[model samples]
Target: MEKLLEILNDIQPDADYETCTTLIDDEVLDSFAILSIVGELEEAFDIEITPVDIVPENFNSAQALWDMVQRLQEA
Candidate 1:
């Protein structure tokens, strides 16, 4: 969770990771931002983010991102 928050903060410093859930819904993260985040996540966590994993539920918040990372790492 902390690592996820770190990654998100690096991309959008103004984002409140704790309070935010739907980053896209809140307008905190757009499509481009999600791409940047995917890049960072791949590098930082050593996991490949597939197109199938690019759903809004997976990238909605810090918790969701963390969950996705865990699932990918397990895969």
Candidate 2:
């Protein structure tokens, strides 16, 4: 989770990722930011983020993203 926070912070340091749940819905993470995050998450977690997994619900919060990563890793 700390690693995830680091990756997220590197992408957008201003936003409070720990508490923000409406990241994509609120436009806190725009397309460009999402692109950055996807790249970072893939590289950091050594997991491939399939197109099917790139949805707002999976990316709306840090916990959601972490859960997705864990699922991908287990798979």
Candidate 3:
């Protein structure tokens, strides 16, 4: 989770990823940022993020992203 936070912070240092749940809804993360995060997550976690996993639900908050990563790792 800390590593996920690091990734989020590196990509966008303005928002509080720890508590923010409307990252996508609030436009804190645009398309470019989302793509950057996807690439970073893929390389860091050694997991593939398919098009199906690119929904706003999975990218909304830090916890959601972590949950998705764990789920993919298990798969």
Candidate 4:
């Protein structure tokens, strides 16, 4: 979770990822930022984020991202 936060902070330092649940809805992360996040996440956690996983729900907040990472790691 800390690493996920670090990745998100590196990509967008302005947003409060810890409590920001409207990251996608509020446009806190643009398309490029999302892509960068996906790349960082995949490389950091050794998880493959498929197109199917690229949904607003999964990228909404730090907790959601952390949950997705854990799920993928178990797979």
Question: Tens digits of per-residue lDDT for model 4 on 1-75?
Answer: 888899999999999986789999999999999999999999999999999999999998899999999999999
True-structure lDDT of candidate 4: 0.95
Question: What are the per-residue Cα lDDT tens digits for candidate 1 across 11-45?
Answer: 88998889789787777898888999999999999
Clashing residue pairs, candidate 2?
Answer: none
After the best TM-score superposition of candidate 1, give how far the Cα of residue 59 lies from its true spot, in angstroms: 1.0
lDDT of 3 by residue, 1-75 (tens): 999999999999999998999899999999999999999999999999999999999999999999999999999
Models 1 onward score TM values of 0.92, 0.96, 0.98, 0.98
Top-scoring candidate (lDDT) = 3
Error of 2 at 30 (Å): 0.6
Best-to-worst ranking by lDDT: 3, 4, 2, 1
The runs of at least 3 residues in candidate 3 whose Cα sits more than 4 Å from the true structure, single-residue gaps closed, are none
Steric overlap count per candidate = 0, 0, 0, 0
How far is 26's C-alpha from truth in model 1 (Å)? 2.1
Q: Model 4 off-target regions past 4 Å?
A: none
lDDT (Cα atoms) of all candidates against the true structure: 0.89, 0.93, 0.96, 0.95
